[model samples]
Target chain A: MSRLKVLLPSARHLVTEELARGVVERYDEAAVGEHTVDFERRLDLGGFDDAVSAVMASHDAGDLSMDGAMAEAVHRQLRLSRREAADPGIWRYLAIVHRPEVVRHRWEYRSFATMRTRFWRHGTRFDANAFSRWWWVAELTVMAEDYSLTHRALGSSALSTHLFSRQLAWHHPTVAACVRILADAPGADVERTLRVLGKMLGLRVAEAMGREELEGLVRAARG
Target chain B: MDDFGTDGLTGGEDEDGTHFRALCKDTLFSNKREEGAGGSYGLGKSVLWIFSSFSTVLFRSTLLETQGLGNPRLIGRTELGSHALGPKRAFQGPGWFGEETKQRRGTRAESVWGPAAAEISGALGFQARNDHDTGTSICVVGFKDPTADADLGPVELARATRAALAEYFWPSMALPTRALTARTEAAGQEVEVRPHDADVAPFVTAWESYLRGEVPAKAPLTKPGDMTVVEVPITIPRTHGGEPEVKGRVALVVRLAAKSSEPRAGQVAFFRGPGMVVSYRDRSRLALGMRPFHAVLACGRGRWPRKPTESDLAVESFLRMSEPPAHDRWEPTPRLKAHYRRGYAKALTELSRRVDEALKELLIATHVMGERGPERLQRRFPIGKAGSPGKGRSAFGMSGLDARPQDGAWSFSGAIERKAGEGPWSVQVRLAEVDEAGRRTEEVAIEALSVTVDAEVVVEGSVASVTVPADVRVVPFRGTSAPCSFTGALELELAGRMVAG
Candidate 1:
């Protein structure tokens, strides 16, 4: 297997707003692909470009949902440690250099303002980036190398946004219990149930609560 | 490690090179350092020797100019504390390597140069410098820093060293003019340390915001990632100069961290010209429940929006002179009398005080009139007199009346409300149990009365006299009902009257 080396983020790696604009105004994968990045060392040793391409291809064919698949693809292919994943630079490099075609295809030829944050933005790493949010979702939801839970959570767009869009995602087990219960309870009105639970959980220490207790509270709120 | 040539060993020949003598001989004094340089007290070099278990260090420096016989110089020094050699003999306890010269009083040593320096450096396994490079490298022969860590091994020590370097100098490394790159090796494996490492990523974001000039000039922080820039003006009173005062401003860049997980979230990285962090002051109390934040107080050349002028340099020197031998904090020391006029300390105090005021403006939510919800809730209570029938037409009255009868006494509680206009309510409450003939049975002593508004509450014997602000419509009060001795039918035996004045 071939290992891929990545660059440490620097001014040279800056994907200027102009470059993102170019990607939008004139859709040129070749111009985006031709930009070279100087790699320092192998913090991310995964050779997963093929995996990313396969998902985008399948998504275009309507064979699979994009979000859950892309999330699983990133988590499975990158194998990023928690330390490496925290850096927005790595995700920026991946979105711009390694998989520009995929990012462009995923978000499509929209306004530069809309597409700019999908690639790079300062201080919005967790929420703004297309690849980072997916990987973090998988990382935060996965149970001991199990991506099954992540799929269940990301399977629903409203559930993911309602739960993980806020700081409540940091309380992993609380989020996990909510995802588990909401995923199982049919017609649970995920948004309405979660809105009520989000307020009640704020008053209590959700992190310290057990899975069963949180699930029970969530289940009760569904009623 | 060799990256030397342009600024190699200086033998203190030229005035610009006098820091060489100061580094070796003077313990706590600074040579005439360049403006915006760090190490004001020149004590950082001592850490090299102090970190070593044997109090010894080796050096190899490439020079741009030299007073010695040859170019790059090599030396070794050891500082064993002052101790005795024999019964009555004592040694000052500092030893040096190189050529010894007979001075006017005794003997002294100087660093070796050229072939001799190369020979010693090669024997100690020091790397060769490129012909174009210029810098100095020192090796703590028996390296150990108990305070940094309890006996860290090569890898752990290297990691700790890299972390400290990145943590303190992260702002410098993240800035557009970043000039430093640090690389470390342990057991033949090299790790390049960068500022955007996960541990310092938040700080890097904060410094990047400052460098990008993303700070807004006003209040009410819009989002978590928003930052506000405030100028902390520092005016130094000069002892003797062309100008009587040096006016300069340092930018205090305060940014709310994007997440609560940001390390050292509530600390303001305090530093001066060299951009080495002197302290991380905890100002978390300023905005108690606001989102965790990271701040940078850049003084001296690190000031933003402009380059450091000659006046800024003068203020930098004044602030540097105010620091103690440790250089950990800047303050008005007794030593300031030599360099600054009277009341020079006020600028330093203002610099510290300005940080709190600026942060509060950005993070602390200000009180807006009529915005508080509790005031609106107070208006919902119906206006009536406390301990009276619902028939008082006064401008201010009480409502939500509750007089719990237990053990032949009443535990009274109610909310005071405004009926008409703005003024004070001078009201009196009486507690007594009445008989069927409308006669007083027993007096219920007024133990305690608490009004939420600022008022003079005088509880004399069994009656309570109180005054409250008419604008504050809600004042929920409750007091203890003393154990009573009058035993009777507690149903229709309670009588109370609230007198309005």
Candidate 2:
């Protein structure tokens, strides 16, 4: 009788249980010709790549402006070529793990994309990813539907780095809009606006503001 | 780490070799300008090479003869080591010893150089036309990691370069601003910069306009208007609902209005507290009791449509009186109840509204801030929420499991109480363990255990007390057992007090 070997995952290996199971279930003895074949080839990384590809693909169809915004961010933060850096599809592969709980959950699956999403969902885990220039553009630049706000949010360095680092940024929805409006101001005006807004908002204003209020702030910021 | 000697000067010494070597040098070569010197003396460039093994300089200076043309230069040298058998050792590397005196400037140029430089430059966007006049531009050679570079996975090289720039540069680089300017282009918009300093005129003008509009000799929001004097009952939330459901009330006039000149329109004030007035100004952030004014205003607002509720009145009046006025007029060492009457009441009402928001933000930020260094935790332990107690000790000098002061020296202990999830609580307990020299034991529990990081364990069987004899050395004695000797043993037990009333 032949002995079956169990493969242990890597320390950096990130995936959720559901994703890993979905990926594993897709493979069968007949379909998976050889045991040595790469698992990614046989199954989707639990729609990780699909999700990323879909997001990037939509930039042209959804909001070209958003694509431009993300590209600018890539150029600023990562200093990468805008054409290559603006792709939203690339984010799916990189997970933003905020907590030990998220890391634990990621290890349960084999899909990198699932890990990335779960990581990105939490503020703590999601924030560090934003500090990394390349990943930051990919994370904040990619929008769910409306790319205009997201693009504008990405273009402003103060909005992206300083404002986002503030206590209020957890109010991401608000943060996204605030940057958009402020992005239009001259460098001096933008700085002044941000400083004033910062002072008025004080600390933890985002959390204090209602979802509606945050959206209002965002609208105000886009001026 | 050993990826050395992969530069252009592969062959030997020639005028071309000298020129090529000069090109590979780390410094900007000649950046002596008349006005504001934009570039450094290649010192920063040298530091960049030391940290990250990259040897390339790109520049366009108005001070140098080569001002406009954005030329890429390769400048470096290969030095010999005394320990080596041969004259020259296997590439001891570029910019290894210090600043390379002989610099060779490269003649390569790229079109995007001007725009790229302009984006980061806070000053004039001088195009590179190679006229050795002034300014500077340098690019450290980058490592090609196909795997990471595939999608700009992580710009390790760029981060290192940024770090290098920050460390070596003397003056802080001001980021270019674009907030107040507008630029239009056929294809793409141009970036602009703005100053961060205050616009003095607008601030002063706004203040003057405000004063001129309403010279309200009677300070705005301070005077109590047609406030009906009536008593009302209130129910503080369960979260903040103290032992007494109904606290107390105060009968005072209340006023609410929308006015001109103010930043936040809605303003409420109280006149009966310790000070003459209490106000609550609603800014973007939560101002629970930021000032007595806010608390009074919130309390006044809460007790609307009817007379003031017991909780509202108590909190309103408490916050008014409890808040130490600006002039240090509020009596020092005021009774806790006197203070709590307002402080606690105000706290309850404010907590009712602000606690949840604070909690959410706190939790999210805590998770996001990432792992802080142990040193930071240690530093914060004395001043942060963790060090709430200790009778205002400020800093607990010892960093052991626990420590207590007595006799002359501070004592250490292994006995600790770790609650389920509370923290490694710090207790002021006398040690069963001995002092530096051999000695007997002494028992003392100076203060109650204060939990910091988490709830701690109640090491059930390990709890023991020792009596330290005055004259004996404090060191652990071998072959000799110290009998348990204390008023009580360390254990987790419920007291008669109940937190929830």
lDDT: which candidate is best?
Answer: 1
Q: Which DockQ-derived CAPRI band holds candidate 1?
A: incorrect
lDDT of 1 by residue, B112-210 (tens): 778878778878877777435556778788887758636777777777767877878876666554545444555566665576775656666767777
Q: Estimated TM-score per prediction?
A: 0.48, 0.19
Best by TM-score: 1
DockQ each: 0.00, 0.00
Residue B216 lDDT, candidate 2, scale 0-100: 24
Model 1 global lDDT (CA atoms, 0 to 1): 0.63
Per-residue accuracy of model 1 over A133-216 as CA lDDT, tens digit each: 788888888777788878888776667766775556667787787787786544348876775565455335676778788888
Query: In Å, what is the interface RMSD of model 2?
Result: 24.5
Off by over 4 Å in 2: A1-47, A50-147, A187-192, A203-223, B1-501
Task: Provide interface RMSD per model, one decimal.
Answer: 24.8, 24.5
Please give, for residues B190-241, the per-residue lDDT of candidate 2 as tens digits: 3222212221112222222222332221122322121112232233322233
- For each candidate, C-alpha RMSD in Å? 27.8, 36.7
